[model samples]
Target: MAVQDGPHQASPRKEPGCLRGLVALVVFVGIIYAIWWFTGGRDGDDEASSTPSVSASATGDRGGSSGEWKAGDCGGPDPDRAPDGYEAYDCGDPDATFRALKIMDGSILPAAVQCPAGTDVIIEVSMNSGSDVKPSGGIPTDTVCGRNLSGDHPGDAGAGGGQLVKGDCVTADVEEIACDQAGPGDLKVLGLVDAGSARCPSGTTDPIRLTIVVGRPYDTVCGREP
Candidate 1:
C-alpha cells in the first residue's frame, strides 16, 4: 500500500564521470611526459657525447707533442734504428737531431720534392692516411722537411758549411756567421747547388765549392753581395 510521502531525502553524492575522465587524462599526460624525458629529452646529451673530439696534439701546432711537428721545430728519431716515428725536443736539447725546415701537405714521398734545398731528412705524419682521419683522434697527415743537426751529411763536412743553408751568411772561408754580424767581405748564400752537374745561379758570385774528400766536390754554395 502506498504510504504517505515523507519529507524528501537527499541522495548520496556520486563523483561525476567527467572528473574521473579528467584525472585519467592528467595521469596519461604525466606518463607521456616521463617517457619523453627518458628518451627524446636525452637526445641532445647523446648527440653531444657522440661527436668526435679534437686534441691539441692532432693539430700539429707549435709546442705540441711528438709526431706533431711544424716548421722550425726540432725533433729526433724515436728508435734511432730504422725509426718509424719522431720525438719532439727542444731546439737547445742535446737529443735533438734534426730541425724542421718546412711543413708540406700530403704523404712523405710526394712532399719530399718540395723540401727546401738544405733538407736532409723527412718526417711523415699519418702517412697513407686521409686528411679527414684527423677528426677521429688521428694525427693530421703532413710531411716535415728537416735538416740534420747531427753533422752527418756531406753538406756538414766542411768548416761551418754544415750549419749553413740557402739564404745564410758566410765568410770567404765558408764559415757560417749571423747575417747581422756579417762584414763587407761576407757573402750571403744564393743557393746550394750540386757541384757535380750544376753551376751557381745567376746574380751570384764567388761560388764556394764544398768538398767531402780531397778532390771530390760535394756541393757548391753560391754566394752574393750581402
Candidate 2:
C-alpha cells in the first residue's frame, strides 16, 4: 500500500536580527564621522597649515643675504650660542645637536649647528614683542641655507625637516625635506605674521621675533595652531 504524503513544510524566513545589525553598523560609522568633523580634522587645528601661502620673492632678499642678516646651521658645535639680544632652547635629543633661530629688533638671524643629513627638525619664530609681521617679500624657494645644498651635495641649508608650530616633535630626513619648496625642506621666509599675528595684527614688535624650535620631523615640532 502507498504511504500518504506528509504535510508540506514552509521555508523559514530570514531572521529580523540580521537586518537590525546592518542598520546599526551604518549608524556607528556616521557617528564617528560626525565627531571627526567637529574636531576640525586633526591638522586643521593650527595656523601653519591654515595660514595662506604667499610669495616671499617680493622682499628682493633672494637667497641668503649678507648685509641685512646672517644665517648659520643648527645642530653643530656650540648649538647653544644665541644671537644678539636673543635666547636659546634645547629642542633636539642628546644624540643630535640643537639649533635656534634668534630674532631681534624685527630681524631674523640664524644660530649655526650641524644636523645629520636626514634629520627632521622644527623652527619656531616669535617676536619678543608679540607683533604682527608684515612680510615685505623674498624669493619663494626651498629652505635657503647658510650653505646652499642645491645641485648634488644635498647639504643645502634650505629647510630639511617638516614644519612644526610651537611644541610638536619631529624626525627629519634628508631626501624628504631636501629639494621641496614647501613643508619640511622648504625655505623659511620671515616677515609674515604666523601665529603672533592673532595677538599683534597691527604690526609692532612687543617682545618676540620668530622663534623657530626645530624638532627633527618638522610636522611634530610645531603643533597645529588651534
Best of the candidates, lDDT = 1
Minimal lDDT window, size 10, model 2? 51-60
Model 2 misplaced regions, further than 4 Å: 1-70, 73-96, 100-119, 128-226
Top of the candidates by TM-score = 1
**Model 2, 68-116: lDDT tens per residue?**
2223433222223322111221234342233323212221211222223
Given candidate 1, what's the lDDT at residue 173?
Answer: 71
> Residue 136: error of model 2 in Å?
23
lDDT of 2 at 86: 17
TM-score of each: 0.35, 0.17
All-Cα superposition RMSD per candidate: 28.6, 22.2
